[model samples]
Target: MMFMKSIFALAAFATAVYAQSVTIAAPVEGTSVTAGQNFTVDIARPNTLSPSQEVAVVIGLVSCSEAPFNGNCASFDVSQIFGTILYNGPYTPTLHNGPSPDFIDFYQNFTLTVPSWFTPGSASLNVAHVSLIGAGPFPDLEVKNITLNVVAA
Candidate 1:
């Protein structure tokens, strides 16, 4: 029981330390996007002290049913996944004035050309952002999903 309590305390502390959030502002949820069309994905990480150069973003498409909610998918099936990585490298998020004079927001915007071979149906666009936390091996991550319909262009 003592060990469990200590573990809980550590988990809470970790959560508090890594409360940074990631937002996908483009391709609004539940909207329809055409395959083979180019669309911009606007990712924003506001008021974070994490270095933008140490942050990386990975964006891809997978079946809505296969999208991971809390953690990695229980079944690691890649058959349902499609589309090449839109962007997979360090991000130099744009700095902008924040709501308060002491804060600043970082925004990373990039264009992705949807694969023309995507089946016309519902799918989830997944964005995984990784930001290094201190010098630890474990990095802070945020995963977001936007469900949208894919139509043939």
Candidate 2:
């Protein structure tokens, strides 16, 4: 019994530590929107390799009343726009390691246009990111949430 408790405690601590690795900016919690209103969110990756690997970063923008089950949530295919993920491309970071540049972020302004079916009320904006190779949408996802108030169309 004691062993199980200790393991649970350790797991909780590890989750807290891991969560700090990523940060989200913009589209502040409780952001208000009407039908089809547009907004942006900035997600920062703590570390990246120089010359940024040629991989596609897919952002999953969704809205839900509860858990994303059945038709409860609506997904937006915010995959790629104009050959740019979000709006920016990979470049070397000022802070480099071993003479190679470090590209560690997806800094872009993406407009999240509320879907017409997103009924007016309180909903959660679920954020997810996955890195992919060409053509394949294999998901290695990390997710977060923000509160929102969706208004009428």
lDDT of each: 0.68, 0.48
Steric collisions counted per model: 0, 0
Top TM-score hit: 1
Leading candidate by lDDT: 1
* Candidate 1 segments whose C-alpha is farther than 4 A from its true place: 1-12, 15-18, 49-53, 63-83, 98-104, 135-138
Candidate 1's residue-wise lDDT over 24-107, tens digit each?
877788778888898888887766543323468788876444335322333443334533566787766787876689877778
Residue pairs with backbone atoms closer than 3 Å in model 2 (clashes): none
Lowest summed lDDT window (length 10), candidate 2: 76-85
TM-scores, all models, native as reference:
0.68, 0.48
Candidate 2: tens digits of C-alpha lDDT, residues 19-96 = 323345567877788866666765554443222222323443344543433234334222221111222333222322
Model 2 vs. true fold: TM: 0.48
| Residue 86 in model 1: lDDT | 65
Candidate 1, overall lDDT?
0.68
